[model samples]
Target: MPKKIVKKGKKSHKNKPTSKKYTKYKIDGDKITRERNCPRCGPGIFLMKAKNRVYCGKCTYSEFESKK
Candidate 1:
């Protein structure tokens, strides 16, 4: 005799919303907001600020200031 297999249908979980929260950092007025270009590297380089100096995703570099 062969055993019977049970198949289940897709379940719905629409009640929950899928969203992501990104951390944002404040930039000072003196902080220069220019298109970052790595001199050592090539073009298409940039950086993102999130409460502090972040690194260039493409270059993998980070910048930060020390508070005395």
Candidate 2:
């Protein structure tokens, strides 16, 4: 008989998705919202919103946010 192996101190991150990674545009009373995507990578790939820029993880394309 083979003994079952277990990994210790590892978090089960696969079960839950991170909320910070997703953001959708809201309208007056619309139930449907669209997610922002990277222009270089098309609609399938999303852009990462950082402190100062929006970045695409796939093609390394980045655009800086304008300062107000």
Candidate 3:
């Protein structure tokens, strides 16, 4: 018996929402709010701020917070 060849389909991204359309920055009276993005991935990707470090889930990038 001969094996049948199958063609691969187009690449697909996960069903979850990848990026938010709204600005990450927020305004509170006279103050401005914002989120830090991943340096390696550029805009649209935000880093998760932890107690000691900031991390990016997409590229596994992280930076430790400096002690002051």
Q: State which candidate has the highest TM-score.
A: 3
**Residue-wise C-alpha lDDT for candidate 3, range 7-67, written one tens digit per residue:** 7897796796545533456677998866688999999888777889998888999999889
Report, for every candidate in turn, its global Cα lDDT versus the true structure: 0.52, 0.73, 0.80
Prediction 1 global C-alpha lDDT: 0.52
The best-first sequence of candidates by TM-score reads: 3, 2, 1
Runs with alpha carbons beyond 4 Å of true place in candidate 2: 1-14, 18-35
Estimate, for each residue in 1-68, the C-alpha lDDT of model 2 and write its tens digit. 89878768867668665464455344548575655688988986777778989888889889998999
TM-score for all models, in order of appearance: 0.34, 0.51, 0.54
How does residue 41 of candidate 3 score in lDDT?
Answer: 95
Best by lDDT: 3
Q: Model 1, range 1-68, lDDT digits (tens) per residue?
A: 88788677878757754431112222568764454444445554545554666566656766663456
RMSD of each: 7.6, 5.3, 5.7
In model 1, state the lDDT of residue 26: 29
